[model samples]
Target: MATGLILIFDKTHFSKYFVVPSTLGALLALAIPDLEGGAHDDIIYNGLNPNAVNNSKKYGINWGYDSHLFWEFLITHFLSLVLPFFLQIIQPKEEKITIKVLWKSIYLTFSVALFLFFFSWIIYAIVEKHGSPAQQISWNANWFYMGHKGISTLGELTKWPYNIISLTIIFFVLFWLVFVIKIYFEIYSFNLSYQNRKIRFFYIKRLKKTVFKENVIKSKH
Candidate 1:
């Protein structure tokens, strides 16, 4: 089984595309609000002649109890904390993915995440306390405003625990964004180097083609 797995990894482009994208995509999906409940409610209540209150109730999905949201929270936070270091490991040694670099990336990611989360709370508090639509609009224009609104609304409607979880989600998203920026720069550097050296470009092109061909072979096998 290990041999088969090794062959599969060696013979597929999974690492090139699936690894990074799937990891990042899962993280992003986890970060976003569970529109799944909304979707399910829409499907279930696909009828006419409902009253306003009933319609509202029908439209609402009990996100508070949804297992998926809990999973998303766990997955997102785990990925945000661990994926940067994981990425560093996967990168070529020549790429200089050092402990220092990994630490810096983690620090930046966590810092940004914390800043956005707290900032969101501050905005939420101000908007809710002020009780002015105009003020809310102004606050919404700010960068961390979404966190504020989400946290405030959830807190007002639900209990403290839920509100705290919501804030944690915001932090996860912020950290994920930082990781994305780091990956972008890494990819950009590779592309720049490839552009400058014909030999490098040749190797990259060959690598991609070989990987694709290997994937096809593996799929057939």
Candidate 2:
């Protein structure tokens, strides 16, 4: 098999049609509350969006666990792609025959996403504890708040070991997210043949032997 470089999209179109919109979408999705009530979901979606809730009911829209899962995947994948693009890092594109690339991508994505989630929690705590009453209320009114309310609620629960429980649940959720991403890559690879394999990979360039020889000769003088 030939070693090749993969180009995802046009770099020139980064500002207009690509990265900006995706960044916004991922942020918005991250900021949206989960549909059903659960401790982890409550932690993530500190304040539920009433409008979203009303719309779902009115339109008969089934925005549940699956919808949240998709957003999580989008967030992970977007971070994986956008962060590398901005840093001028080139990741090996996923080849159909090799899953090594997929594993690498997922590992990086999961690490970054985990760091971000923890960072968000820290910020939430700082704001809730130190901010003014209005600030605290407004913060909890948004989906990003995961401070006193959620944690305190868990704390109040019949003296249960919620901290340990929450951590355990978090571990499983993250594992599941990685599994879902892997499955997605597998499906995409399986479908490549019928789609004309739009993914393009180019060989990495290297200097010719003559040029290297000339450089070495010049350096020796």
Candidate 3:
């Protein structure tokens, strides 16, 4: 998947525009989940590690209290889809890029990033109070996952409402993987194709070394 995305962007004229923005979007998708009331820690310590004590309980953190997993899944996935377009919208109209445009771009990128995060957080807050009985019960049950082999929510996913919620989360996770692939290509293509003097020299030197090793192996064979 990453190889395919790299080929697509590397062959395109707009690769530069795609790289930074898509990388940013992928990073945000990876990070926003951390704010879900430390459920990740619970999953690790409680679910994955049988011998480990229940960290959430020890720390007195209310389990799954801040997790509107379904909503979070939606917002971040949606934002990743639209982030590239939003970045384009904020680009200056002037043909020549200037310092001012650079500054503005930085400012707008941060603004959009913040807006995506806060918008999801706000939605989570508003609707959290109205979580269905199934959601509440499942969350409590799944929290501090008592030696589960999979995700904290894995057990809950077998039942109603939780089944639906888990499905939504899965949908978004697959959706976000596309942008993550682009991030890999962004780093890869930068190293392989960038023309900057220092970067080009470094990659060229590495390539020569690799080719030299391959030739030595072929000669021995």
Q: How many clashes does the backbone of model 2 have?
A: 0
Q: Estimate, for each residue in 1-221, the C-alpha lDDT of model 1 and write its tens digit.
A: 21235335763222222233334435554465445444443443454333443435543354444657656656655654454345445654422322333344445444654576577667767876874644554554222223443433334632232444554455557545654565445444443344445544322223444444433343343
TM-score for each of the candidates: 0.32, 0.30, 0.26
Q: After superposition, how far is residue 125 of candidate 3 from its true place, in Å?
A: 2.1
* RMSD, every candidate, angstroms: 17.0, 13.6, 18.1
List candidate 3 stretches off by more than 4 Å.
Answer: 1-14, 21-104, 132-221
Clashes of each: 0, 0, 0
Please list the residue runs of candidate 2 whose C-alpha ends up more than 4 Å from where it truly belongs after superposition: 1-97, 137-221
For candidate 3, the C-alpha RMSD (Å) to the true structure equals: 18.1
Q: What lDDT does each candidate get?
A: 0.44, 0.40, 0.40
Flag the better candidate by lDDT, 1 or 3.
1
- Ranked by lDDT from best down, the candidates are 1, 3, 2
Task: Give the clashing residue pairs of candidate 2, or none.
Answer: none
Task: Report how far residue 8 has shifted in candidate 3, in Å.
Answer: 8.4
What are the clashing pairs of model 3?
none
lDDT digits (tens) for residues 1-221 of candidate 3: 22235346753323223434444445544544333334444455343552455554443233334656646655655655554444344542311122233334444444553454445444444545876533333333321111121233235663333433453355345434543453343334433444655434233223544443432343343
